[model samples]
Target: MTNNKTILVVGGTGMLGKPVAQQLKVDGFNVRLLARNPEKAQKLLGDGFEIIKGDVDDPAALRSALTGVDGVHISLKGGPTEADFDHMDHIATRDIAQAAKELGVGRVTILSAYAVSEEKADTPESRSKLKGEAALKSSGVPYTIFRASWFMETLPMFVQGKSISLIGNQIHPLHWIAAEDYARMVSKSYQTDETLNKELYIFGPEAFTMGEAMKIYAEYAGVKVAPISIQMLAVLGALTFNTEWKGMAVLMKHYENWGEDGSPDEANHLLGAPATTLKEWCNKRYSQPVNS
Candidate 1:
C-alpha cells in the first residue's frame, strides 16, 4: 500500500519529530527528514531514507529539502523570541506553507497544542502554534493538526529532591500524554485518510491533578510526601522559564491549571481509542514493582 511514497519530515531531528520519522519508516513509507545538520539525524540514517540538510526557515534549503515529497510533517518549536510569540509563529509557518505548496506536497500534518485558543492568541507559544495552523490551511494543502497535551516524561520536574512538588491542593486535574503516542499517531495519519483535513486534540486516557501526578510518582518511588501550594506568579515565571530548564518550566505552565480543557474525551475521535488513563499509566509507568 505504501507504493514508496516519499514523506518529508521537517524537524525530524527533534524530540517528537525523530520518533515520528522513525515510526513512519516502521510503517513502510519512504522517509526524508529535514535537519539543520544532516548528521544530527544520525540515528535515522542507513535505513535507505534520505536526510536533506536545511532549516525550516530557510527557503533555498527547504525548496531542495522538499523535492519529490508527497506529504509533509511539521514538528516545529519556536525559539526564544517566541517568548512573546506574535512575530515568530505566522512568519515561519508561512514560509513552510509556501514551500510545501511550491513543492507540490499533497498532505501536511502539523503537530500543534491542545489548549491553544483564540483568546491567548498572543501568548508566544499559543499564538505561534495558531499561526502555524493558519499557514497550513492557507497553503491549500490537505492538513491535519495534532493538538496534544503535556507529555508524561516531564514528570521529573514535579519530583525535585527525589520528592514530587505540589501546587495548591493535590486535587487539581492533570492532562497527560506520552511523546511516543503523538509520534505514532502523526506517522499513522499519513497512511490513513481518517485524520485528513482536520485539527485533532489528542490526550492520554485520564486526567490527574498536579497533586495526583506527584502522589503517583511518590507512591511509585514509595517515599514520604505531602501536598503544598506556591504563589501563582512565581510558579508562572518559573514554568514559563527564561533559563536552562526552560522546556520543563514551559510545560509546567501549561499544566499549572490542568490545562484549558476539562474533558479528556478528545482521544475518542482521531485515534479512536481511549488514551492511557492515570491509573493505567501509574501502574505501567511509575507504580511498577519498584525494581521496574
Candidate 2:
C-alpha cells in the first residue's frame, strides 16, 4: 500500500535513524531527510529520498523542513557533556515540536530510552530525554514516543580489535531489539491514528543479559570477552582524551544501576513485536568474515 503522506526525518544519517528512514521509503511514504550534510545523506540513503540541507539546531531549517510534511520522526543522539544533551536532545526536540505545531503537522514521532523517567532522570542524557518527551507532549501536536530497549546492533561496538570489553556487571535481562524491527514499527505507527499521542515501550521477543548477548557475538566474531571495571574505562577515557569512551563508561554505569521497566504488550499489540533473537541477529550480521 502506498501512503500519500510525506514524512521529514531528523537525524537521518545516524546509526538508528538510517534504518527508519529507509523503512519509511520502503513502506511507500514520501521520505524527506533534514541532514546537516546533504551529500553524506545522499551517499548513505541514495536516491528516492528528498535530502534537505539543515539540522535541528537551526529553527529556520526546521521550519522549512516541517512545512507541508505530514509527520516528522526525530532520532537524535548527544554526547559526553551535559550541555550537549540539553541542546541536541532537549532543545532540538522542543524546537522541532514547536515547528511541527506551527506547521500543523499530523504527527511527530521521537526515539527515547526505556529507562527515562522522572526518578531516573539523574544523568544529563536521561534528564534531556525526559524533558524532550515532555516538550512533545506539551507542544499540542499529535505525537508518538518510542521508549525502546537496547539494540542488538550496539553489541558490535563493544568489540575493539580482537578483544571485547564488558564495562560493568550488567545483570539486567534486556530485550535486545533489532534496528529493522524498530524501523518497521515506526513506519507502522504512521499508518494508524490509534497509535498517535501515546508513549510505546518497544521490546524484542528474547531476553538476555549484556554478558550473554556479548558471548554470542564474541563467539561469532572470534573474539574473547573481558570484564573491564567502569573506573578503568573512565581512566582510559581520561588518559586517551576519548569522549566516546568516557560516555560509554557513564552509560554502562547507568544501565548497571537501572533495569528496563514497563511492559511491551501495548507496543507489540499495536505495531507487532520484535522477533529477532541474538543468535538470529549474529547469523545475519556475522555470517561472513568479522570486520573487527
Candidate 3:
C-alpha cells in the first residue's frame, strides 16, 4: 500500500530499530527495513513488512536502499565485537548520509546515546558515534538527533547471584529510560515537522542513582543488592584491557565523572512523555505470573 510517508530503517532488526519501525508502521508510515540478513529480518519482523537486503558496509547497497525513501532512521551501533567486525557506524554513516543527500531524502534522524559531546567522546565507541552524528549534520538533509540516556535493560545485567556489580561508585544518578518509551519518541520524530534540524535529549520518567535504582529491583527480587568494589572494577579493567570487557570499564570511568542527573523535562514535554512509571515497569518485569 502506498503512503504519504516512507521511512527506511537501517539496522531494523536490532533492539531499538525493531520497536521504532513497528511504532512508525503503526502510526501510518510506510516502513522499509534495510537489514544485512533479510531472512533473519523476516523471521523477527514477520510478514507484510518491506525489506531490502543490504549491509551498511557496502556503499552500493546503501545507494540502492535510499532510493525513493522520504526519510531515514539509523539505529546502528559501533562498540565491542561489532565495532571490530564491521566498523559500520563510523564508515557506513557517511556513505548513507551522502546517499540520502544525493537521492534528495528530506529527513534523517539518528538514535544516539547521551553523554556524547565534543570533549567527552573519549572511547573508540563514542568517537565513532560522534562521527556518524557529524555526517548526518553535514549531509544538508533536515535531521533530528535524539541522544538518550541508559536503557532499562542495563539494570538487569547488574544482577549477579545475590549481589550486583555497581560500575564506578554507584553515586552518579542516571536517567534510565525505557526502550519502548524511546521508540515512541523516535516514531513521532518522523511525523512531526517541528523536530526537523534539531538535536534533542531524552531520558526516563525518573532519575535514580545505581544504589537507589537497585533498591527497587532488590525489593522486587526479594534479595539484597550490594555494590561491587572499586578495587574489583579496577582489576577487571586491567584484566580486560585489550578486550571487550574493557569497554564496560571505560563506560564506568565515564560515569564516575558524571556528577549530576540527565534532565528530560524539556524533551519529554515536546514529545509527550511516556506514561510508564519506574515502579510500574518493575512490577511488570519482576512480578510472577498467576497460575492458570
Tell me the whole-model lDDT of each prediction, alpha carbons only: 0.68, 0.90, 0.76
lDDT of 2 by residue, 58-84 (tens): 778879888999999999998778899
| Candidate 3, lDDT over the whole model | 0.76
145 Cα displacement, candidate 2 (Å): 0.6
Stretches of candidate 3 off by over 4 Å are 81-86, 161-163, 221-226, 229-231, 237-242, 259-266, 288-292
Top-down TM-score ranking: 2, 3, 1
lDDT tens per residue, model 1, 159-248: 657566564443445567777677777776776787778877777656776666656667666653555444553455576674434543
Tell me the alpha-carbon RMSD of every candidate.
4.0, 1.8, 3.4
What value does the lDDT take at residue 279 in candidate 2? 79
Identify the candidate with maximal TM-score. 2
Model 1 is weakest, by summed lDDT over 10 consecutive residues, at 242-251
lDDT at residue 243 of model 3 (Cα atoms): 55
For model 2 the TM-score comes to 0.96
What are the per-residue Cα lDDT tens digits for candidate 3 across 187-281? 87776788888778887767788788777767776656676665576577677675545666666777666544445666676788866656777
TM-score for all models, in order of appearance: 0.79, 0.96, 0.87
